[model samples]
Target: MERSPSAQADLRGGVIWIALGAGIAVLSWRMDRLEHMHVNPYTVPGLVPGLLGAGLVVLGALLAWRTIHGGALARVAAPVGVDRIGDFRVVATGALCILYATLLIGHLPFWLATTIFVFVFTAAFDYKERRTAGTLARGLVVALIAAAATAAAVSLVFEDLFLVRLP
Candidate 1:
């Protein structure tokens, strides 16, 4: 008979996701077919993304329907103590990722850009545990190694194994 604020929030998010997924699927359908290149019909450039978008739409619709069926909006609209700082951190992380993808990827070497991105992300997130004097060095070393390893693994997978081109 009652629901929490979180349920209402999830309902709202599900609607947004549904709309986004539909838009993506539509755009994907409208993309160029590259018929001139004699590409295989099954291997169309938008095939995977379009399918993903459809999947999202279905999943989001299911989520919204589930929330509604659960009577998410039936409860009183009580104020939930929102984590503004955590939200800010999430937004900042997204911005950093966008920067890494758009500005860094094409301009710099793939390995170097990926390494820097991974290292900075790791260090920034782990700052609290690394604040102490004794563990600081160890933390930094670990982060550096992790970053390098991640970069190498990614490079090997995309460049060598998948034969995908990297900028």
Candidate 2:
């Protein structure tokens, strides 16, 4: 029974997730409840987050267990090379999201910002698969359509259906 690199990585990641979830649950528990306002106990500020944290902890533990002793127990003759491009894309997407949330949201109109973000993100990722000029142009068109459609759907859902304000 040999452990693959993925399994070892998963075991490590699962432990981190378990710790993060527990910390979230603890913080949620320590949050103040608006007893003076006679807010319903079920409607406590931390209720949903607390439940989510507990769920994360449970799932993380299960992941760790499975990686160490379950399907990941299969033996492998050689380690595979890490996908640098894929990793870069993941980090880039995360950074793009953070920028969109922190810098773009209020600075630009919500629909416009969302459209631009989606367009750029889609084009950047899509370029990996099809790098030719024609394909790139087609990808941009596709990205534009996707961005417009997504923006419209989100605006309708939040503004009309949910009645929530967009930044």
Candidate 3:
């Protein structure tokens, strides 16, 4: 018997979700194990990742069940369009931002690094309206405030609270 298109799409989505979930679980487990070298033994860094991984695993199981029992095979058979330009731009920008942060962290100081990063990242998404000077002014003000707040929070957490030095 032929299955419906929606059913097939659901099955495909289920498979994709399951695969992603498995990947996340594996990475989370690895991260949890690696974070054990921190000063406090009782302070488990892996807890967050472990919980997230478990949640993903449960979600994957539910998706798989729905795909199997809800007749989703037909939906998975549909043809889909690919948009490579947007995907490439997103990946490239993300990589550039990561590289920028790593290289600038120690050299530029936290406040400068963070301010520049926030401005560049926010502007990159075209969030700043060019026609409205007020909008741009507001965006810059907000970015500066946020950057300062982030720096303060980091300083408080690492320096004052944990007595750890920032790089």
Candidate 4:
């Protein structure tokens, strides 16, 4: 039987997700293996990734099943021109945030770095627009809370609990 374009896209997306999940699982397994020498068996480095990978695998499997059995999917309207620019901007902003977190966190204090990261990243995404004030405010609040909680957690886990030092 012939399928609609949306169905074909769903099938393609499901296949892609499944492949990605498989890759993640493989990498997690490899990391787990390598971590054996450094990490105690009870504290496995791959534990989180392994679980996430497994979840992704299951989700991908479900998507694939829906695509195959649920009949033709609905067609989504493509956004006319200029939408690609926003997409690229989002991608670029994410990459920049990751780079800043990975490379600059060492040089700057956690709170200071995180605040700047949040503000700059938010502004980068055009959060200055009137409609975005609420979102930006929410984002800032969440970022602050998350950063504080993360710092406290790390301190408690490494300093008080595990006796490890933070970088």
Q: TM-scores for all candidates?
A: 0.53, 0.53, 0.42, 0.39
lDDT of 2 by residue, 1-167 (tens): 24346776787888998999999999999988889999999999999899989999999999899887855556562456767776797899999999999999999999999999999999988896768554878898999999999999999999999999999
For model 1, the stretches where C-alpha displacement exceeds 4 angstroms are 1-79, 132-134
Pull out the clashing pairs in model 1: none
Compared with the true structure, what per-residue lDDT tens digits does model 3 show for residues 1-167?
A: 24334655655676777777777767766664444366564555666766776777678678778777866543445444545666677796987688666887888876667667766666555453642555766676676677677777777788889988766
RMSD to the true structure for each prediction, in A, is 7.8, 7.2, 10.6, 10.8
lDDT of each: 0.88, 0.87, 0.66, 0.68
Which pairs, if any, clash in model 2?
Answer: none
Off by over 4 Å in 3: 1-80, 126-134
Q: How are the candidates ranked when ordered by lDDT, highest leading?
A: 1, 2, 4, 3
The C-alpha local distance difference test score for the whole of candidate 4 amounts to 0.68
lDDT tens string, model 1, 102-156? 9999999999999999888888877776886557777878889998998999999
- Residues 1-167, candidate 4, lDDT per residue (tens digit)? 24235666677888888888888888877874445377566567777787788888889889889977876345454433435666788798888888777976788765466556655665555455523555766666665666666566665787778886555
- lDDT for 105 in candidate 2 is 95
